[model samples]
Target chain A: MKTKKLINDPKVIIEEMLEGIVAAHPKHVRQVEGAPRAVVALNGPRKGKVGLVIGGGSGHEPTFVGFVGKGLADACPIGNVFASPPPDPIYECAKAASGGAGVLFMYGNYAGDVMNFDMAAEMAGMDEIEVRTVLTTDDIASAPLDQKEKRRGVAGNFFIFKIAGAACDTMKPLDECERLARKANAHTYTMGVCLSPCSLPQTQKYSFELGPDEMEIGMGIHGEPGVAKGPIQTADAVTDAIMDKILGEMKPNKGDKVAVLVNSLGATPLMELYLLNRRVKQRLDQVGVSIHQTWVGNYCTSLEMAGASITLLHLDDELTGLLDHPCDCAMFRAG
Target chain B: MKTKKLINDPKVIIEEMLEGIVAAHPKHVRQVEGAPRAVVALNGPRKGKVGLVIGGGSGHEPTFVGFVGKGLADACPIGNVFASPPPDPIYECAKAASGGAGVLFMYGNYAGDVMNFDMAAEMAGMDEIEVRTVLTTDDIASAPLDQKEKRRGVAGNFFIFKIAGAACDTMKPLDECERLARKANAHTYTMGVCLSPCSLPQTQKYSFELGPDEMEIGMGIHGEPGVAKGPIQTADAVTDAIMDKILGEMKPNKGDKVAVLVNSLGATPLMELYLLNRRVKQRLDQVGVSIHQTWVGNYCTSLEMAGASITLLHLDDELTGLLDHPCDCAMFRAG
Candidate 1:
């Protein structure tokens, strides 16, 4: 199949996208001096505040870059599509985002991201800046409960980031912000299903192959192998399958309240997400769990990959208060 | 092509979707009593305020329904797929939204919508509830400059509804709100390109057809024929073509400021939209028209159609202030 993308050249796609982002959101973000890959929020970093820096692969837009602004991420170091950023840009982002209260690095728990961000933290330490790291592992299907640390982060990262961003915005110390980030990640869970493969911009080639009538549950955002592959099923059946896995592990008691996000991976439309949400609500209702807040849209995506993910952030009083705090980002706003 | 969708019983897609929306956004919106098709905002309508009621076909996910919340539309009566709602539900929407100041009806300039909304206005009139209407005609390619009123509305409807919503929310009288709505519609210009067709829920068939290597410029949201059709071009070429028509119609002087919306119709990802925005910025920079604010996303979508639209709202102090006013909606929140 033809790529059918609206791009000038794939090699310069990231640069063009970054330029486009800064142009479109000049008031919210700006590229760091001498480091084009590092985008820092214009109004987020302040003295006496713990700076928040997030970064990852580029395809999942509105994730790292779009989250940079007041009351959210202080800076975002961008990478090429489906690839992690190098330590230089990450270090630059840390340097640019650092307030007197220190800085925290947060991103999805991937091998490349972990390695690169650790090296950047080392660099920041050598520069006499305190930097902490929190890796988000929220995808329940990637690992068993006994091995939760191995789980990959997906759309649940949105909630984790939001809670941490709120903490940082409220002048929380580095220890408190790091604790809240870990707490948010521990409470968040997500699972995804892929209907079709997305092609890479550079190669214009499919990342993975599936039969035309087949779908895959528990697929990774970067087209990693999924837990199950079978013929496409109805929306309710699919939702039930994913919810079974989540509910089996979560085991929330009655009266528990959680925030929900039915997110489109990219090509999935809002109509389908809402359909999935209907079943999710029904399943939660059957279990006597109540939804506190719900967000349905393309929050974290894998380029034009056709899929959707459901994320639940089990909220406590503190988490709920933080989740409801005002945030003004380039792509996300809430109170 | 085989229809691969995450839905059950396409016959009840709308009802299920409405149920899903209410379940997810209970704090922001609710279904009107005895009027299943009518959704009213939970916090927007106030006594003595000029109520804003916006509606249209249902396929545009966030257009009519997602926009109903505080500081936006007071209510939205949904239609079926690409069809318009009948007079009964629209009348109910007016009656439920009225706050004694009056009610204003706003939507795209479509034949079915105009007819139904007019009949609903007549019904509201019989009940002694003053009613006004403002039709958005912003698709520059749909009609000649001399025949502007014949043009169809598209994604530009976001700005029109936003400005009018702000006007009504601030307690502007019905006449002033109507004037502002008309002003906003006159200043907005939009053009779209279609890369592929979207399948209807009921039929599970493509709404329109295009060759593998072809695209149509200025296609309507519901797959209406466009002004130009030919082989696919580069992103810059496509953006240039669309901007040419919009700029020609707008003809803003140098140093003038405007707001920009690089909107995805549905399946076109943010990666492509930013690429288009890059070109759009370049084109505007060459002409010296500065962008005051930019929104890039799927604001008004046509199910899973693969395409995008560019909307420019020429802004003065009033329009700029109104655009920046805070709005808390289920799908769109902006300030």
Candidate 2:
């Protein structure tokens, strides 16, 4: 069967979606003037406060845009499915989020996002709006333990965005907010597994093929290769496998507190996520890692891809307080 | 490929999921002692307030369980996949939620849930605790206008639950809380379309089949047949088709306000939901209905089902205020 989609013209999907978002959430967001792809907070970037701008490809709903709210990202420039926004919108986002205080640009460390955001930062510099970039590298499977800098960011982007956004709400200086964001990134870890592939609207073809009994561990959000592929395993076995890799790297000692996220990668059901969480909590209990909180739902996705990712954010007293901060956006709000 | 799922035993899925939920959200919820499937709010059902218990089948996560928090449903009983909870758990849920005041049992109006909840209510009545039920029959395609009571509930359950829960927060009496619930259900209307079918874990077989180019309009949450089936259509066309049936029966005059929910049935991407919402907002605009707030995500799902549902709650001042009232839940919160 052909992959079915509800779209008019694939090329204009992003613009149409942006229009819908701003219209549906007029009080929360608006399109940046002359930057159709940039979605800016309607009530953010107040005076004497550092501005936080986040962006990345589309498909990961509530990730880059749903997170932009009163105390989260001030602006998010959207891109095509699994692709990065261009420099123009990214620059416009920096300008919009700039509250006289300098701007901080953050996103998952994809090659396209890094290049385009870097370009946008350069453009913001030309306008005398200083900008700093923090590329999130939390996907443990993307790189070896000794080379964590090369890891790709996955669901852990949510934590980095929240910590930095909360810091900005305190009217913190740009340097301090950037430091908090880096610290958040350093303590975050994520790993994912995909059961099926997601097709693109334009192409109408599946991105990858897996056998009936196969599962791929550490699959990237955009169908990038993972560390291993084998027959599908039980929920407990899968948890152990993924956690083995993450805990090996993160190594949160006993008595440490952490926040856990069991996120669906598009098409996975909540029942499955919760079932997986059952084992996740068991393992955390055995390891003596105290769960400060838990978020289980479809937070970041791959546009109908069938999979899930687990994210762990090891929290200190400071990080816990910052994460508990409240903010309201379109799809997510937390305190 | 076979339908992939992350579960240990299909037989114990509900029990295991409930365990995970209480473990992960100890502050928000707990499993009623000796009634493991009956999940009750840890901090709710306080004295003097009207107790609110809402529940239904499993698979539609964040619907019945996620809504159990402060100012929302005080309890929700777990069921097997796509099946309703038995009377025992439902009865226990009511007893746990009861705090001297009466209990209001609200949920989707399906035969199984109705029968089970009715049995539970009868049991509660034996204890001298008044129990009132507000059955949601809001699916526009399920019945004729004059036979609205015969309709089945779909995504509209969210609005009904929220409004009724908010009313209970006012410490209203049983009759008044039931009145508010009935008012909320009367104003709520929903329509859904499916692009693919969901499979059961035990069977690993698709619930239904659509040709590569086919779609089903007004499909029920559990793969029940819809009002119409045809070749797949564009996003705008689909939205217009769904909205036409909704508006024809609703007949909302100009100057009416509404809360819109563009819900994904498990696997539909958020981009498509937004694309559909663009047309929904446009049609509502042309019809002169003012959108008060919009929600676009996986609110009600069918366990990896690929479809979307649209729900509109025509709101008066009271309902609108109640909807905007603050409530903190596991998956949903509003202020």
Candidate 3:
């Protein structure tokens, strides 16, 4: 498609967006010059509090950036849309957030993010900063629970963030913080269905394609291919398809408590998410999995695709308390 | 071109979306069940506080609904994408929000919104409920300021919301609140450019079209036909063209304080919005217009259109105080 270039240059889009982020949110986040998406806490770290950090591509709002605030990730390094941020930015974020107690790096299971964050951890160690990495591999379709390294991260990353934020608030050591984040990730699973492909700005075209009336199941946020495609179904059916996989993997038994997130992948209206959420709660209720809380909205979107994703996180006492912690931001806040 | 039938029935899209809004913001907003997009104060209005109600279409997140909080609009009556909510719903919103101090009905200047909100005003009057309408007609291309009725409302509706919200919070009477809102709207002006069209759920297709390398200037939120269409160009050139008309109408004098909003039309990424915002600020700086504050993001979106609109609200002491008032919500809290 022929599209107007709204950016001065394709190269500067990421840097400029980071600058605007600093301008718009002076209290919650600050960006270092020449380091795009390398955001840190404006108020430093609270004494006796562990620090939490997360990072990924730039397109998803309220994710790596929007989720940075009290009772959430203390700092988030952002990459360009559909791209992974580099190691230096990640390293800087860790250093800035580390409160003397230590810092935990919680990120999605994407290969690029994993590799870059690992390198940054090594760098942080050289600077006498204790850092640990917690990878979230919650897409059940990507791998079995025993082989979580192969799974792709999805909306369940929110669970990891919530746990890490809460653990850090209690001043857990780096080891404990990483352990809790991993535990949260292991207990969470997510699956998504897309009605349309998300478009890239510079490319000015969709990242992928599917037939009309077709939906892709178990898709990743970066427009990665899905596990299956089939004729469109009712919202209830789609919710069942996603929740079944997530629930099966989590294996919640009777009386088990969980938090559910019904996320819109950009273009889906709020109406469909609610309808799908209602069906999800109904199905879960029948299965005896008690939904302690629910988050339904565009917390994680894939550009403008008409799609939705479902994520379920089995919760424990610590996780539940963390999830209940208050958050404050323009995109999301939970108390 | 063909499109997918994502929902069971196209007609149910709006109803479903509103249900999702209620689910997502249960603590902050509640859907007037069976009433299309009419949401009232979750915690009933504070006694003796004036009420501010505003709304229009569904796709503009936090615009009408997201802005509802302590220092902004109290309720919103939503319509389908780019459509106005009915008079009944708007009236319900007014009735629910109004305290003994009366109500201020702020809205965009679209024909449907204007007509429906006006009707609601008359209905509220019949019930002996004092109500006033502050119509926002900021799109410069739609009409000249001298011909107020000809101007179309756009993103500048936010300025009215801010002013009205503050006025009402201070217990201003119905007429004073309306006067302040209208004054803010009158001092503001806006213009937009569309690189892509927003897809309405029911239509399952884009509302308008642009060739692969083309853009429409002076476009409306509803995909109302623009004043011009031409091949896409550099960000600087596009900014120059759009700001010329908006600034010409509002005519921000040198040394005058003003607030700028560079808004994304749903699908545009934050990276691009910031780039556009940078150019916008640079242009305004060159023109010697002092920017009191600026915000750039998807404040008012049109489905998933990959375009943007700019709004300039001339700031005086009253408007500044209103803009500084604190707000708390999931989307925007510009108090």
TM-score of 3: 0.90
Backbone clash pairs for candidate 2 read none
List, residue by residue over A178-242, the lDDT tens digit for candidate 2. Answer: 99999999999999999999999889899899888899999999989999999998887888998
Model 3: CA > 4 A from native:
A1-5, A33-37, A46-48, A199-205, A251-258, A269-275, A281-296, A304-306, A328-334, B33-37, B253-256, B287-293, B329-331
The window of 10 residues in a row where model 3 chain B has the poorest summed lDDT is B1-10
Query: Model 3: per-residue lDDT, tens digit, A145-250?
Result: 6877888877888777877787787677778888888888878878888888876666767778888778888778887878888888888777777777777666
Estimate, for each residue in B1-335, the C-alpha lDDT of model 2 and write its tens digit.
56788888888888888888877788888888998888888777888888999998988987889899998889998888877899999999988889888999988879999999999899999988889888989898888888988989888898999999999887888888899999999999999999999998888789889888999999999988899999999999999999998898789999999999999999998899999999999999999999999988888899888889999999899899889878877778888
In terms of lDDT, the best-performing candidate is 1
The C-alpha lDDT values of all candidates are 0.92, 0.90, 0.75
Q: Model 3, residue A20: what's the lDDT?
A: 63
Per-residue lDDT tens digits for candidate 1, residues B270-290, read 988999999999999999999
For model 2 the local lDDT of residue A129 reads: 94
Chain A TM-scores, candidates in order: 0.98, 0.98, 0.94
> How well is each residue in B1-335 modelled by candidate 3, as lDDT tens digits?
54543354557766665555555555667766556568875654677887888888777765767677666777788787677888999988878887877888888877788889999989998887788777788888776568877777777777777777888877777777778887888788788888877666666686677887888888887777788889887666788888877677667778778888888776565556666677777777787877777777667767667788888888887788877877655345553
TM-score of each: 0.98, 0.98, 0.90
Which structure is stronger by TM-score: 2 or 3?
2
TM-score for candidate 1, please give it.
0.98
What's the best-to-worst order under lDDT?
1, 2, 3
* Deviation of model 3 at A305, angstroms: 4.1
